[model samples]
Target: MSALNTSVLRPAGFILMGFPGIEHLQHWLSIPFTVLYITALVGNSTIILVVKFEQHLHTPMYVFLSMLAFVDIGLCTAVLPKILEILWLNSKDISFEGCFIQMFFIYMFVTLESSILVMMAYDRYVAICNPLRYTTILSKTLVCKAFVAFFIRDLVLTGLIPTLASRLPYCSSVCISHCYCDHMAVAKLACTNIIMNNYYGLFVALSILGVDAIFVGFSYIMIFRAVLKLGSKGARLKALNTCGSHLFVIMYFYIISLFNYLVYRFGKDVPVHVHVVFGVLYLLIPPVLNPMVYAVRTKEIRHAFLRHFLPRKIDSDLSHR
Candidate 1:
């Protein structure tokens, strides 16, 4: 065998896939990203704390909501700090390994979040369609089993891409055209012909986003039908109210996801703002928005938020004084 090379594949120049001139505008981003980062951390984290802290939230809906919070936290951590550093410090530098790791967690957390939404849809369907059998249908045992299965499936699907990615020979243009290590963007720069890789990535992407979209669609159909059967305009509105929050959050993510892939992946000459802003929003916005939607739109989570965290806030101020 030939001698093994030991050089680390850190890119030489500004090979970032984001908006350029961060050096000039980077200062402006600090305040906004800092505020966003902190808000997302506190909000998403509170969702988790509330669900776990309150006894009333020991049901399937809250369990998956907690899982959604967990996913939000993970995705936020995966993308935000590096982005903040790049923006604030004028450093668009990320090593290949760091990029790879970030890509893995981003994909994994995204998959988990999507799966949790699927679970939530199912939970909503049962609650609305089979009220008497909700608990029996979604028991602790069944939920645990489903969680385990979802976790494993997400882990496997996302992990496969990174494994394949690590082995590919990448060109020196380490400029990933997005803020994070979007698999498609990275794949585009690989020196090797990536038919199989593209196929696999497409399969996995469609599987998570596509399949979940279908599930959400079908569930809503059944839900709407059931609501029609009830024959109460008020009940129909309430049923729709229960769904609006998730619908907005889901539509936003998928639309951005489709836009990212379509504009960058298919169409060349992607704008810099699309890379920096859209990529950041792709991961962080949902976390920030999802919790707000849950708190403001969904009553139970709002009450749980009040019960678990509100008094702590009151006590903290009292203690500080």
Candidate 2:
């Protein structure tokens, strides 16, 4: 028995069927996807560079934004290049190892983003709820510690999902209906029952996302209470303004993620193309939008971007005009 090959059979690889129903439109679809990918890359890279070089913006909030931009870059880069390859070059084969690697990074970046958002909420809570101690509380050392803690938490939690999925005996078809190695999409191909994997994925997802949502919502509630207690209307508005962008980002992210989760779980009748497109967007949209949201809503980022990127002559011309 020891000499009888005991290892389970694994698929040679997975074929990423990108937008299965719309094969004719894939060439056209690649145009928009390419634009979004490029935009996400440039926008996030700009945010990171601006924050790093601009000393005036070296506060806790900007630091967290920079971290978010970095993660956003990773999140999109993990999936888009392969997606573009499938769309543009008709290359769709992802090695088993490559698929697992992509799955791990996708989960890691997502969970890490959740933790960072919580940290951002906490940062706002401190800024609004306890202004005097903001500097002392979120000091350089503590920020470093928070990043490490978030990274470790996500590493352990997100790492388990792909690890569990990878262990399944995938002795069946290897065609993944979606563009990337989505957790459930891959799980469904296992010849064995995936009830535990299904529930575990849900549990871990809810634990990270659900818990993050509740905490962020609570922090905002506390922030509002503090804002109301302020003596000046200007102070109240300023506090609310500070939180508006972060809150919008949270709502946008959660809404799409929760919808996608629900559809995957319950929307059996939902068209595969619809689900796939949303899945792609769920991962892609945030990276493309986060920097735009911050730049549009936050004056410091806007001014800094103009200062660094806009031509001096044009800036002076605009000012003069």
Candidate 3:
């Protein structure tokens, strides 16, 4: 550790430049963002509540779905509040500790979500391909282990990012060019050598999300193969239908995330706002969309919603009429 690194360990703070060129637009942008945050909160919370109260949803698939919803809520809560503050109140100053803390939860939940997707893919694979053995394979004990393993893996692996970044001496400008405290965005502000940080970040991204994505892809391929082999067309369609929601979630999460990652890594010539906008989208869209996707695509979730809330809605409507 250099003397400069030690001196700047506790620098003043960082100023988050929400939107540089269109500062006025940030307030306008808050409208949609606020809508998204509320939608994500309400949508995911509904899923969690439904899964908890609905006895029929106690299967492995819905257990994993509930876990995904919980992670979505954590992910949105980690970034959206600070972003709203920056957009609405113009309060962008974040202490060094605060920035790293936010970065920690953001990475933690993102990786956890990735792991959950992989688990969901596996759940679908077993249910569709080896239906007779799905219960035995994805038993309650195994599901508990899966959750513990992924949570620990994410905490241990993704935790390195913030831990390493926090140690770096940020002797340069403290103005971050984005709304939230992204690891790379904060790393770019450091004056010292960040080659280790950059490389480690890439390694973590590939090892966690990359490996999980590969497994998910392989699982789906096997699933499709099995589905195609079924003698009855109705059987094939039914099997594939169960997987629709999980597949859409995988595509939605990875597309925005990969786009943002590629842009951050290689799209240097791209405009700054473009990077910031996509980064925000990557964080925002999946949480907002995940529960809705499941609610629309999965029959049981819809029925659970109706079973729990539809009667109340009907009664209220009749009273008003």
- TM-score (all chains, Cα) for each model: 0.87, 0.91, 0.92
Please name the candidate that would achieve the greatest TM-score relative to the true structure. Answer: 3
RMSD of each: 4.1, 2.6, 3.2
After superposition, candidate 1 runs with Cα above 4 Å error: 1-17, 21-24, 269-272, 311-321
Candidate 2 clash figure, as a count: 0
* Ranking of candidates on lDDT, top first: 2, 3, 1
Clashing pairs in 1: 15-175, 17-176, 17-177
What lDDT does each candidate get? 0.77, 0.87, 0.87
lDDT of 1 by residue, 210-304 (tens): 88878987887887778778778898788777676578788888778656545654656765665557767778889888888775677787766
Question: What is the C-alpha lDDT profile of model 2 across 193-298, one tens digit per residue?
Answer: 9888888778877888889989999999999898889999998888677677668878788777767767777889999899898888878999998888775578
Superposed Cα RMSD, model 3: 3.2
**How do the residues 1-321 of candidate 3 rate in per-residue lDDT, one tens digit apiece?**
776666676586899999777786998999999999999999999999999999989998898889989999999899999999998888999988999999999989999999999888899889877889998999999999988999899999989999999988787788999888888889998888888988888888788888888899899999989888999999888867766666777877777776776677778898889888888887889998888777656878987787787978757867999
lDDT of 2 at 147: 88
